[model samples]
Target: MRLLLVEDNLSLADSLTRALNQCGFAVDCMHNGADADQVLRTEDYALVILDLGLPKLDGLEVLRRLRQRRNKVPVLILTAHGSIDERVKGLDLGADDYLTKPCDLTELEARARALIRRSHGFDSAELTFGPLSYDSVSRVFSLPAGPLSLTPREHAVLEVLLMRGGKAVSKDALSEKIFGLDESSSPDAIEIYVHRLRKKLDGSGVAIVTLRGLGYLLETRDAAA
Candidate 1:
């Protein structure tokens, strides 16, 4: 899944970004609320981690504006403000959850998972396609051989394909989702990643099919052939 993290504290943001990325999320980090707002407006996010203390635009306004547009992507407010009133206000303003600063990263991840699960309307932790079983939280892809741990990028690539299951996903689309808007990674970089993924999935009975000029599709070999 993709997450937008709007935090101004450089050290905190950097640490949080790494932690979330390690947990299998493609995270886009912005140091200011204005940039965060722009990213939210332009990109699709599975969840947002927002802080109230921000530059350019206060985080509350960002939440307000997003709600004004009826954007329902789950927002988990993270702030130093732990007052009862502040917490109530954030919830009233449509935040899915709230976490105080200096909080445990594990707890933050748990909240994120809960929000994402609620947003997707899915109760199970495993996503299955044919013989493949993916655990979104653990970042493991299981098959007949046993569980295989994936690098964050590999997980991001597979997550998109698996989530769409039977669809043709364009290379450009995959690039954007995996690398974000300011991607310096070339199309060749994406191909390299796909090639590695294909080899891993090859002969494993889970199909990751390539369609020249169109894009790539993931399905059973029988379905594709």
Candidate 2:
């Protein structure tokens, strides 16, 4: 799934970015709340990880503005302050969950999965589309023919298509959801990744359908004789 991580600590941010990427998530990271707010406003994301102590704008204000705009994207508030009032304030402002500083990465990942599942109304741990299945916890993709190894980018793209199946996701939307501004990656870069992914899934009876000027949709192709 796609995620926005708003944390200011350079070391922590880098480590979290690398870890989340390895877990088959297309993570767009921002070090300031201002940039985080901008991304949240402009793009669609499955979840957001926000730090309370952020530069430019506080995370609470960011959350408030997001709610003010009627954006219901799941948000997990991460803060050094782990008190009753702080938690209450974040929850009142519409954060889905909260994690204190010095938290366990595995635990944080678990919470993220739970929030995502709850948002999608999925009670199970796996995300499935036709014959392809993805284990969000294990970060593995399974298919009937042979399991395909998916990079984070590939996984992210597929997740979007699976979530909004039959809808054409524009290239601009896909790039924003996957690469984000932190990488300085471009739409052309997204095209290249999608091309490679198409090749990998070719002849497998699973199609990433190109919609000409629109973008892409994933669907199952009828079996050939």
Candidate 3:
């Protein structure tokens, strides 16, 4: 999954970006709220980690514009100001969650994961499709036979597919989610990962089907028939 980290504090932004990347998230960072706001309007993100004290534009105004335009991407506000009014104001402006500065890394990651799950309408970290099961927290993919070992890229691809349920996911969408906004990736790279996943899941009763011009969809072999 990809996340936008809009924070001006260099040290904190660097640390958070590194940690989020280690946790299997593709992260893009912006220091100014204006740039962040524009990026949010143009790109897709699993979530946004926004700091209130941003340059150029206030974070609250950016969020307000996002909500006014009806962009429902989950936003987690990060601020040093922990006043009740500040928290309530952010919520009123459509922030999905809020975290005070000097927060624990583990707790922040957990909260981000929870927000992503909720945004996708999933109440739990486990997502199951046919005989395939994935635990988001453990980053484990399993079949009826056993747990399936996957490369990082393969896991990222499968995460997008499973999260979309049975719906088709476009190549561009998958690319952005897996590669992040700043990374340059070819469609062939995504194909290689998908091909590898297909092999690993060959006899697992689940299949990744390409829809030619449309995209790819995960389907059970029986359902395909």
Candidate 4:
């Protein structure tokens, strides 16, 4: 999943980015809240890790504007303010979850995974489509035979498709989720990953179908039949 991390603390941001990436999240970090606010408005993210203390624009204001625009992307507030009033205010402003600074990495990752799962309307960590099952927490994909071996890019593409279920995911969306905002990857890069994934998933009961200009959809062979 792709997540935006809005934090000015370079050390914390670096650590969180590495940890989240290891946890199977493609993270884009922005130190300035103004930039983050604009990115949130323009980009599609699975979740946002927002820090209340920001440089140009306050994180609370960013949250307020995002809510005012009716953007429902899940947000988890990471701040040093540990007061009940502050927590209440953040929640009121549309934060899905709140975590104070100096938090354990494990706890933060757990909260992130929980929020992402909930945002996707999944009650559990395991997502299944036909014989394919993915454990979101462990970032593992499995079939009836055994665990599926997929390159990181292929796995990321498959995750996005599975998250959308039967819906078509555009190439632009896939590129954004896979390469993130900082990378300079073409839409053709997405096609390469999709082609590789299709070859690997052949005869797996699930197929990734291209809809021409409409993009790609993951469907069961039986459904297509």
Range of the 10 consecutive residues with the lowest summed lDDT in candidate 3:
216-225
Candidate 4 structure quality by residue, lDDT tens digits, 20-92: 8988788999999999988988898999999999999999999999999999999999999889998999999
Which residue pairs collide, candidate 3?
A: none
**Candidate 1 Cα errors over 4 Å, as ranges:** 149-151, 180-183, 210-214, 221-225
Please provide TM-scores, in order, for all candidate models, with all chains considered together. 0.83, 0.85, 0.96, 0.95
Error of 1 at 30 (Å): 1.8
The lDDT of each candidate is 0.83, 0.84, 0.91, 0.90
Quick one: best TM-score, which candidate? Answer: 3
Best by lDDT: 3
Candidate 2 per-residue C-alpha lDDT over 1-225 given as tens digits, one digit per residue, 9 for 90 to 100: 778999999899999988987766778889998998998888888899999999999999999999999999999998898999989999999999999999998999899988987787666788777777767777667777877877668877877776674578888888877765557777777787788888888777777888899998888876461
The order by descending TM-score is 3, 4, 2, 1
Tens-place lDDT digits, model 1, residues 48-83: 999999999999999988998899999999999899
- Once superposed on the true structure, which residue ranges of model 2 sit more than 4 Å away at CA? none
Candidates arranged by lDDT, highest first: 3, 4, 2, 1
**Given candidate 2, what's the lDDT at residue 187?**
79
Per-residue lDDT of 66-85 in model 3, one digit per residue for the tens?
99999999999999989999
